[model samples]
Target: MPLTITIPQEYGYVLLCSTATFILSNWHAMRVGSFRKSAQIPFPNHFATPEQIAAASGDRKEAMHIFNCAQRAHYNFLENYVSFLPALLIAGLKFPVSAAITGAVWSVFRIVYAVGYTKKNTPNGKGRIAGLYFWPTQLVLYGLAGYTAYSLL
Candidate 1:
Protein backbone atom coordinates (compact mmCIF):
# COMPACT_ATOMS: atom_id res chain seq x y z
CA MET A 1 0.00 0.00 0.00
CA PRO A 2 1.28 3.46 -0.89
CA LEU A 3 1.40 6.00 1.88
CA THR A 4 -0.75 9.00 1.18
CA ILE A 5 -0.99 12.54 2.49
CA THR A 6 -3.79 15.06 2.07
CA ILE A 7 -3.00 18.70 1.57
CA PRO A 8 -5.34 21.18 3.19
CA GLN A 9 -6.52 24.58 1.99
CA GLU A 10 -4.42 26.29 4.62
CA TYR A 11 -1.26 25.06 2.95
CA GLY A 12 -2.01 27.41 0.07
CA TYR A 13 -2.34 30.27 2.53
CA VAL A 14 1.04 29.41 3.97
CA LEU A 15 2.51 29.50 0.48
CA LEU A 16 0.98 32.88 -0.16
CA CYS A 17 2.37 34.17 3.10
CA SER A 18 5.79 32.86 2.23
CA THR A 19 5.64 34.58 -1.14
CA ALA A 20 4.68 37.85 0.50
CA THR A 21 7.63 37.61 2.86
CA PHE A 22 9.93 36.97 -0.08
CA ILE A 23 8.58 40.01 -1.86
CA LEU A 24 9.10 42.16 1.20
CA SER A 25 12.66 40.97 1.52
CA ASN A 26 13.29 41.79 -2.11
CA TRP A 27 11.81 45.23 -1.68
CA HIS A 28 14.12 46.03 1.21
CA ALA A 29 17.13 44.85 -0.78
CA MET A 30 16.08 46.99 -3.71
CA ARG A 31 15.65 49.97 -1.47
CA VAL A 32 19.17 49.52 -0.19
CA GLY A 33 20.51 49.25 -3.71
CA SER A 34 18.66 52.35 -4.79
CA PHE A 35 19.97 54.29 -1.84
CA ARG A 36 23.50 53.16 -2.60
CA LYS A 37 23.17 54.33 -6.20
CA SER A 38 21.65 57.63 -5.24
CA ALA A 39 24.39 58.21 -2.68
CA GLN A 40 27.00 57.32 -5.30
CA ILE A 41 28.39 54.59 -3.08
CA PRO A 42 31.12 52.91 -5.00
CA PHE A 43 30.94 49.16 -5.15
CA PRO A 44 34.23 47.52 -5.72
CA ASN A 45 33.67 44.50 -8.01
CA HIS A 46 29.93 44.65 -7.27
CA PHE A 47 30.38 44.01 -3.57
CA ALA A 48 30.41 46.54 -0.75
CA THR A 49 32.74 46.21 2.16
CA PRO A 50 32.08 47.77 5.54
CA GLU A 51 34.61 50.45 4.83
CA GLN A 52 33.08 51.07 1.42
CA ILE A 53 29.60 51.40 2.87
CA ALA A 54 30.81 53.81 5.52
CA ALA A 55 32.69 55.84 2.97
CA ALA A 56 29.69 55.93 0.66
CA SER A 57 27.53 57.68 3.21
CA GLY A 58 30.35 59.85 4.50
CA ASP A 59 29.32 63.01 6.37
CA ARG A 60 25.68 62.58 5.26
CA LYS A 61 23.54 61.86 8.29
CA GLU A 62 20.32 61.20 6.40
CA ALA A 63 22.05 59.02 3.83
CA MET A 64 23.65 56.96 6.56
CA HIS A 65 20.31 56.56 8.29
CA ILE A 66 18.66 55.40 5.11
CA PHE A 67 21.42 52.94 4.32
CA ASN A 68 21.43 51.55 7.83
CA CYS A 69 17.67 51.18 7.96
CA ALA A 70 17.52 49.45 4.60
CA GLN A 71 20.39 47.14 5.45
CA ARG A 72 18.87 46.30 8.82
CA ALA A 73 15.50 45.52 7.27
CA HIS A 74 17.00 43.25 4.66
CA TYR A 75 19.25 41.41 7.10
CA ASN A 76 16.52 41.07 9.69
CA PHE A 77 14.27 39.33 7.18
CA LEU A 78 17.08 37.04 6.06
CA GLU A 79 17.84 36.06 9.64
CA ASN A 80 14.24 35.36 10.50
CA TYR A 81 13.40 33.66 7.23
CA VAL A 82 16.11 31.05 7.72
CA SER A 83 14.28 29.76 10.79
CA PHE A 84 10.78 30.56 9.54
CA LEU A 85 10.97 28.73 6.24
CA PRO A 86 11.84 25.37 7.73
CA ALA A 87 9.35 25.77 10.55
CA LEU A 88 6.65 26.71 8.11
CA LEU A 89 7.44 23.74 5.89
CA ILE A 90 7.33 21.28 8.72
CA ALA A 91 4.22 22.82 10.22
CA GLY A 92 2.39 22.84 6.91
CA LEU A 93 3.28 19.21 6.44
CA LYS A 94 2.40 18.07 9.95
CA PHE A 95 -0.44 20.34 11.00
CA PRO A 96 -1.61 22.15 7.96
CA VAL A 97 -4.53 24.26 9.12
CA SER A 98 -3.16 25.67 12.35
CA ALA A 99 0.33 26.02 10.97
CA ALA A 100 -0.90 27.85 7.94
CA ILE A 101 -2.85 30.30 10.06
CA THR A 102 0.15 30.87 12.26
CA GLY A 103 2.30 31.34 9.20
CA ALA A 104 -0.06 33.92 7.82
CA VAL A 105 -0.09 35.81 11.08
CA TRP A 106 3.66 35.70 11.23
CA SER A 107 3.90 37.04 7.72
CA VAL A 108 1.71 39.96 8.60
CA PHE A 109 3.86 40.71 11.61
CA ARG A 110 6.96 40.58 9.48
CA ILE A 111 5.47 43.02 7.00
CA VAL A 112 4.59 45.39 9.76
CA TYR A 113 8.08 45.08 11.14
CA ALA A 114 9.65 45.84 7.77
CA VAL A 115 7.42 48.77 7.10
CA GLY A 116 7.99 50.11 10.57
CA TYR A 117 11.71 49.90 10.12
CA THR A 118 11.71 51.54 6.71
CA LYS A 119 9.14 54.31 7.02
CA LYS A 120 10.15 57.73 8.30
CA ASN A 121 8.53 59.70 11.12
CA THR A 122 5.79 57.33 12.21
CA PRO A 123 3.62 59.05 14.82
CA ASN A 124 3.33 58.15 18.50
CA GLY A 125 6.25 55.73 18.41
CA LYS A 126 4.09 53.47 16.29
CA GLY A 127 6.81 51.99 14.14
CA ARG A 128 9.09 50.88 16.95
CA ILE A 129 6.17 49.69 19.01
CA ALA A 130 4.80 47.72 16.11
CA GLY A 131 8.08 45.90 15.64
CA LEU A 132 8.49 45.27 19.34
CA TYR A 133 5.01 43.82 19.58
CA PHE A 134 5.20 41.56 16.55
CA TRP A 135 8.70 40.12 16.90
CA PRO A 136 7.93 38.07 19.98
CA THR A 137 4.68 36.86 18.48
CA GLN A 138 6.48 35.60 15.43
CA LEU A 139 9.09 33.90 17.57
CA VAL A 140 6.39 32.18 19.57
CA LEU A 141 4.72 30.96 16.42
CA TYR A 142 7.98 29.54 15.18
CA GLY A 143 8.55 27.84 18.49
CA LEU A 144 5.10 26.31 18.46
CA ALA A 145 5.52 25.06 14.93
CA GLY A 146 8.88 23.56 15.75
CA TYR A 147 7.59 21.88 18.88
CA THR A 148 4.65 20.46 16.99
CA ALA A 149 6.95 18.97 14.39
CA TYR A 150 9.28 17.59 17.01
CA SER A 151 6.44 15.98 18.89
CA LEU A 152 5.33 14.18 15.76
CA LEU A 153 8.71 12.54 15.39
Candidate 2:
Protein backbone atom coordinates (compact mmCIF):
# COMPACT_ATOMS: atom_id res chain seq x y z
CA MET A 1 0.00 0.00 0.00
CA PRO A 2 1.28 3.47 -0.89
CA LEU A 3 0.76 5.80 2.00
CA THR A 4 0.24 9.48 1.41
CA ILE A 5 0.87 12.26 3.87
CA THR A 6 -1.37 15.27 3.89
CA ILE A 7 0.01 18.72 4.53
CA PRO A 8 -1.94 21.87 5.21
CA GLN A 9 -2.50 24.29 2.34
CA GLU A 10 -1.44 27.17 4.52
CA TYR A 11 1.98 25.56 4.59
CA GLY A 12 2.54 27.02 1.13
CA TYR A 13 3.42 30.33 2.72
CA VAL A 14 6.10 28.65 4.81
CA LEU A 15 7.57 27.09 1.70
CA LEU A 16 7.64 30.45 -0.03
CA CYS A 17 9.37 32.03 2.92
CA SER A 18 11.79 29.12 3.05
CA THR A 19 12.67 29.59 -0.62
CA ALA A 20 13.34 33.27 -0.09
CA THR A 21 15.56 32.47 2.85
CA PHE A 22 17.45 29.98 0.71
CA ILE A 23 18.10 32.63 -1.90
CA LEU A 24 19.27 35.07 0.75
CA SER A 25 21.52 32.43 2.25
CA ASN A 26 23.03 31.66 -1.15
CA TRP A 27 23.69 35.34 -1.79
CA HIS A 28 25.44 35.72 1.53
CA ALA A 29 27.69 32.73 0.78
CA MET A 30 28.48 34.02 -2.68
CA ARG A 31 29.34 37.45 -1.31
CA VAL A 32 31.66 35.77 1.17
CA GLY A 33 33.33 33.73 -1.58
CA SER A 34 33.87 36.75 -3.80
CA PHE A 35 35.28 38.83 -0.96
CA ARG A 36 37.46 35.95 0.19
CA LYS A 37 39.19 35.81 -3.20
CA SER A 38 39.68 39.56 -3.26
CA ALA A 39 40.93 39.49 0.30
CA GLN A 40 43.14 36.47 -0.59
CA ILE A 41 42.09 34.60 2.51
CA PRO A 42 42.98 30.90 2.12
CA PHE A 43 40.57 27.93 1.98
CA PRO A 44 40.79 26.93 5.64
CA ASN A 45 40.89 30.39 7.15
CA HIS A 46 37.78 32.42 7.90
CA PHE A 47 39.67 35.72 8.01
CA ALA A 48 42.89 36.87 6.44
CA THR A 49 45.81 36.83 8.84
CA PRO A 50 48.14 39.82 9.09
CA GLU A 51 50.66 38.42 6.59
CA GLN A 52 47.95 37.32 4.21
CA ILE A 53 46.27 40.72 4.34
CA ALA A 54 49.55 42.47 3.69
CA ALA A 55 50.20 40.25 0.68
CA ALA A 56 46.78 40.72 -0.94
CA SER A 57 46.75 42.25 -4.42
CA GLY A 58 43.80 44.54 -3.77
CA ASP A 59 43.13 47.34 -1.31
CA ARG A 60 44.46 45.18 1.56
CA LYS A 61 42.71 46.77 4.51
CA GLU A 62 39.25 47.21 3.00
CA ALA A 63 39.33 43.86 1.23
CA MET A 64 40.14 41.99 4.44
CA HIS A 65 37.61 43.95 6.44
CA ILE A 66 34.83 43.37 3.90
CA PHE A 67 35.68 39.68 3.59
CA ASN A 68 35.55 39.25 7.35
CA CYS A 69 32.15 40.92 7.49
CA ALA A 70 30.84 38.76 4.63
CA GLN A 71 31.99 35.57 6.31
CA ARG A 72 30.38 36.61 9.59
CA ALA A 73 27.13 37.50 7.86
CA HIS A 74 26.94 34.15 6.07
CA TYR A 75 27.61 32.19 9.24
CA ASN A 76 25.18 34.28 11.24
CA PHE A 77 22.36 33.51 8.81
CA LEU A 78 23.07 29.79 8.99
CA GLU A 79 23.05 29.89 12.78
CA ASN A 80 19.55 31.36 13.01
CA TYR A 81 18.20 29.51 9.99
CA VAL A 82 18.79 26.10 11.51
CA SER A 83 16.67 26.78 14.56
CA PHE A 84 14.03 28.73 12.65
CA LEU A 85 13.36 25.94 10.16
CA PRO A 86 12.57 23.26 12.69
CA ALA A 87 10.53 25.55 14.87
CA LEU A 88 8.63 26.81 11.86
CA LEU A 89 7.77 23.34 10.63
CA ILE A 90 6.72 22.20 14.06
CA ALA A 91 4.65 25.30 14.61
CA GLY A 92 3.02 24.81 11.26
CA LEU A 93 1.63 21.51 12.39
CA LYS A 94 -1.00 23.39 14.35
CA PHE A 95 -0.79 26.98 13.17
CA PRO A 96 0.40 26.88 9.61
CA VAL A 97 -0.72 30.34 8.54
CA SER A 98 0.61 32.01 11.65
CA ALA A 99 3.89 30.17 11.41
CA ALA A 100 4.29 31.13 7.77
CA ILE A 101 3.56 34.80 8.40
CA THR A 102 6.07 34.95 11.20
CA GLY A 103 8.59 33.03 9.15
CA ALA A 104 8.12 35.41 6.24
CA VAL A 105 8.63 38.38 8.54
CA TRP A 106 11.88 36.86 9.75
CA SER A 107 13.07 36.17 6.21
CA VAL A 108 12.34 39.74 5.18
CA PHE A 109 14.13 41.27 8.15
CA ARG A 110 17.01 38.89 7.60
CA ILE A 111 17.70 40.58 4.29
CA VAL A 112 17.83 43.95 5.97
CA TYR A 113 20.03 42.53 8.69
CA ALA A 114 22.45 40.90 6.26
CA VAL A 115 22.62 43.84 3.89
CA GLY A 116 23.27 46.20 6.77
CA TYR A 117 25.92 43.88 8.16
CA THR A 118 27.76 43.46 4.86
CA LYS A 119 27.66 47.17 4.10
CA LYS A 120 29.06 48.22 7.46
CA ASN A 121 32.56 47.16 8.59
CA THR A 122 32.02 47.43 12.32
CA PRO A 123 31.30 44.48 14.64
CA ASN A 124 28.01 46.04 15.73
CA GLY A 125 26.60 48.11 12.94
CA LYS A 126 23.24 49.27 11.62
CA GLY A 127 22.36 45.67 10.70
CA ARG A 128 21.52 45.05 14.32
CA ILE A 129 18.62 47.47 14.08
CA ALA A 130 16.59 45.22 11.83
CA GLY A 131 17.12 42.33 14.19
CA LEU A 132 15.14 44.06 16.89
CA TYR A 133 11.96 43.78 14.86
CA PHE A 134 12.61 40.13 14.06
CA TRP A 135 12.56 39.07 17.72
CA PRO A 136 8.84 39.65 18.15
CA THR A 137 8.09 37.54 15.13
CA GLN A 138 10.30 34.76 16.42
CA LEU A 139 8.54 34.90 19.75
CA VAL A 140 5.21 34.43 17.97
CA LEU A 141 6.57 31.35 16.22
CA TYR A 142 7.71 30.00 19.57
CA GLY A 143 4.28 30.59 20.97
CA LEU A 144 2.80 28.66 18.06
CA ALA A 145 5.23 25.85 18.69
CA GLY A 146 4.06 25.68 22.26
CA TYR A 147 0.48 25.46 21.07
CA THR A 148 1.35 22.66 18.68
CA ALA A 149 3.16 20.78 21.42
CA TYR A 150 0.34 21.14 23.85
CA SER A 151 -2.16 19.97 21.25
CA LEU A 152 -0.08 16.88 20.59
CA LEU A 153 -0.09 15.95 24.27
Candidate 3:
Protein backbone atom coordinates (compact mmCIF):
# COMPACT_ATOMS: atom_id res chain seq x y z
CA MET A 1 0.00 0.00 0.00
CA PRO A 2 1.05 3.56 -0.50
CA LEU A 3 2.47 5.54 2.37
CA THR A 4 -0.55 6.94 4.24
CA ILE A 5 1.44 9.27 6.41
CA THR A 6 2.47 11.58 3.64
CA ILE A 7 0.95 15.05 3.85
CA PRO A 8 -2.15 15.33 1.69
CA GLN A 9 -3.59 18.32 -0.13
CA GLU A 10 -6.64 18.11 2.07
CA TYR A 11 -4.40 18.41 5.10
CA GLY A 12 -3.10 21.69 3.74
CA TYR A 13 -6.64 23.00 3.39
CA VAL A 14 -7.45 21.86 6.90
CA LEU A 15 -4.37 23.65 8.13
CA LEU A 16 -5.61 26.80 6.48
CA CYS A 17 -8.91 26.36 8.23
CA SER A 18 -7.17 25.93 11.55
CA THR A 19 -5.06 29.02 11.00
CA ALA A 20 -8.13 31.07 10.11
CA THR A 21 -9.87 29.97 13.27
CA PHE A 22 -6.90 30.92 15.40
CA ILE A 23 -6.77 34.33 13.81
CA LEU A 24 -10.45 34.90 14.38
CA SER A 25 -10.29 33.79 17.97
CA ASN A 26 -7.46 36.22 18.70
CA TRP A 27 -9.25 38.96 16.79
CA HIS A 28 -12.34 38.55 18.92
CA ALA A 29 -10.26 38.55 22.08
CA MET A 30 -8.73 41.80 21.04
CA ARG A 31 -12.14 43.24 20.32
CA VAL A 32 -13.27 42.27 23.78
CA GLY A 33 -10.16 43.81 25.26
CA SER A 34 -10.90 46.97 23.35
CA PHE A 35 -14.36 47.05 24.86
CA ARG A 36 -12.98 46.55 28.34
CA LYS A 37 -10.44 49.29 27.89
CA SER A 38 -13.04 51.63 26.51
CA ALA A 39 -15.23 50.95 29.49
CA GLN A 40 -12.27 51.39 31.78
CA ILE A 41 -13.49 48.40 33.77
CA PRO A 42 -12.66 44.81 34.47
CA PHE A 43 -14.10 42.07 32.33
CA PRO A 44 -17.21 40.04 33.08
CA ASN A 45 -17.78 36.31 32.80
CA HIS A 46 -21.28 35.85 31.35
CA PHE A 47 -22.58 38.62 29.17
CA ALA A 48 -20.49 40.46 26.55
CA THR A 49 -21.49 43.95 27.52
CA PRO A 50 -22.38 45.88 30.63
CA GLU A 51 -25.51 46.96 28.84
CA GLN A 52 -26.83 43.49 29.45
CA ILE A 53 -26.69 44.02 33.17
CA ALA A 54 -29.93 44.45 35.02
CA ALA A 55 -31.56 47.84 34.76
CA ALA A 56 -31.44 48.23 38.51
CA SER A 57 -27.67 47.88 38.54
CA GLY A 58 -25.15 50.39 37.25
CA ASP A 59 -22.57 50.47 34.44
CA ARG A 60 -20.22 48.18 36.31
CA LYS A 61 -22.67 45.34 36.13
CA GLU A 62 -23.11 45.83 32.42
CA ALA A 63 -19.37 45.90 31.87
CA MET A 64 -19.00 42.72 33.86
CA HIS A 65 -21.59 41.00 31.74
CA ILE A 66 -19.77 41.86 28.51
CA PHE A 67 -16.49 40.69 29.97
CA ASN A 68 -18.05 37.40 30.96
CA CYS A 69 -19.37 36.83 27.46
CA ALA A 70 -15.97 37.49 25.96
CA GLN A 71 -14.32 35.10 28.38
CA ARG A 72 -16.77 32.29 27.68
CA ALA A 73 -16.58 32.73 23.92
CA HIS A 74 -12.79 32.77 23.99
CA TYR A 75 -12.52 29.55 25.95
CA ASN A 76 -15.20 27.75 24.02
CA PHE A 77 -13.61 28.74 20.71
CA LEU A 78 -10.28 27.29 21.81
CA GLU A 79 -11.84 24.06 23.01
CA ASN A 80 -13.86 23.50 19.86
CA TYR A 81 -10.94 24.19 17.56
CA VAL A 82 -8.60 21.92 19.47
CA SER A 83 -11.03 19.04 19.44
CA PHE A 84 -11.70 19.37 15.74
CA LEU A 85 -8.10 19.80 14.60
CA PRO A 86 -6.99 16.26 15.31
CA ALA A 87 -10.08 14.85 13.73
CA LEU A 88 -9.44 16.93 10.65
CA LEU A 89 -5.90 15.67 10.49
CA ILE A 90 -6.98 12.08 10.68
CA ALA A 91 -9.60 12.55 8.05
CA GLY A 92 -7.26 14.52 5.86
CA LEU A 93 -4.70 11.73 5.56
CA LYS A 94 -7.34 9.19 4.68
CA PHE A 95 -9.94 11.31 2.92
CA PRO A 96 -8.40 14.61 2.00
CA VAL A 97 -11.11 16.27 -0.08
CA SER A 98 -13.84 15.45 2.37
CA ALA A 99 -11.79 16.61 5.29
CA ALA A 100 -10.87 19.84 3.59
CA ILE A 101 -14.46 20.56 2.64
CA THR A 102 -15.71 19.86 6.14
CA GLY A 103 -13.01 22.02 7.62
CA ALA A 104 -13.89 24.82 5.26
CA VAL A 105 -17.56 24.60 6.14
CA TRP A 106 -16.83 24.57 9.84
CA SER A 107 -14.57 27.59 9.50
CA VAL A 108 -17.23 29.57 7.67
CA PHE A 109 -19.86 28.76 10.25
CA ARG A 110 -17.59 29.72 13.09
CA ILE A 111 -16.89 33.09 11.57
CA VAL A 112 -20.56 33.75 11.04
CA TYR A 113 -21.34 32.53 14.49
CA ALA A 114 -18.83 34.81 16.14
CA VAL A 115 -20.07 37.87 14.34
CA GLY A 116 -23.69 37.12 15.11
CA TYR A 117 -22.94 36.35 18.72
CA THR A 118 -20.87 39.46 19.31
CA LYS A 119 -22.49 42.14 17.17
CA LYS A 120 -26.14 41.65 18.02
CA ASN A 121 -25.80 40.23 21.52
CA THR A 122 -28.04 37.56 20.07
CA PRO A 123 -27.92 33.80 20.34
CA ASN A 124 -25.77 31.80 17.93
CA GLY A 125 -28.64 31.12 15.61
CA LYS A 126 -26.81 32.02 12.44
CA GLY A 127 -23.88 29.92 13.45
CA ARG A 128 -26.15 27.08 14.44
CA ILE A 129 -27.94 27.36 11.15
CA ALA A 130 -24.66 27.23 9.30
CA GLY A 131 -23.69 24.22 11.37
CA LEU A 132 -26.89 22.50 10.49
CA TYR A 133 -26.32 23.28 6.87
CA PHE A 134 -22.84 21.82 7.06
CA TRP A 135 -23.73 18.71 9.02
CA PRO A 136 -24.11 16.56 5.95
CA THR A 137 -20.72 17.63 4.69
CA GLN A 138 -19.13 16.76 8.00
CA LEU A 139 -20.90 13.41 8.09
CA VAL A 140 -19.67 12.61 4.61
CA LEU A 141 -16.10 13.39 5.62
CA TYR A 142 -16.44 11.31 8.77
CA GLY A 143 -17.91 8.44 6.84
CA LEU A 144 -15.11 8.59 4.32
CA ALA A 145 -12.51 8.53 7.02
CA GLY A 146 -14.17 5.61 8.75
CA TYR A 147 -14.45 3.74 5.50
CA THR A 148 -10.77 4.25 4.82
CA ALA A 149 -9.84 2.87 8.21
CA TYR A 150 -12.17 -0.10 7.88
CA SER A 151 -10.78 -0.97 4.47
CA LEU A 152 -7.36 -1.37 6.05
CA LEU A 153 -8.67 -4.01 8.44
RMSD of each: 4.5, 3.8, 4.5
Looking at candidate 3, what is the lDDT of residue 73? 54
Predicted structure with the largest lDDT when compared to the true one? 2
Task: Kindly give the number of clashing pairs for every candidate.
Answer: 0, 0, 11
Candidate 2 C-alpha lDDT tens digits along 41-118: 789898767676566654667778777767876787788778788788889877788888889888777777767766
Instruction: Name the lDDT value of residue 150 in candidate 1.
Output: 73
Candidate 3: tens digits of C-alpha lDDT, residues 1-153:
674556765467767765776787778678668656644554443344435455425655544555555555555567676656666766777777677778788767656555444443344323334334434555565676677667656
* Descending-lDDT candidate ranking: 2, 1, 3
Q: Per-prediction TM-score, please?
A: 0.70, 0.80, 0.64
Candidate 3 lDDT (Cα, 0 to 1): 0.60
lDDT of 1 by residue, 15-113 (tens): 776677678778777887886675455654233445755565444534545555656666777888888877776677666666667776776776677
Q: Which ten residues in a row have the lowest lDDT in candidate 3?
A: 123-132
Model 1 residue pairs with clashes: none
lDDT of 2: 0.76
Off by over 4 Å in 2: 1-6, 50-58, 120-126
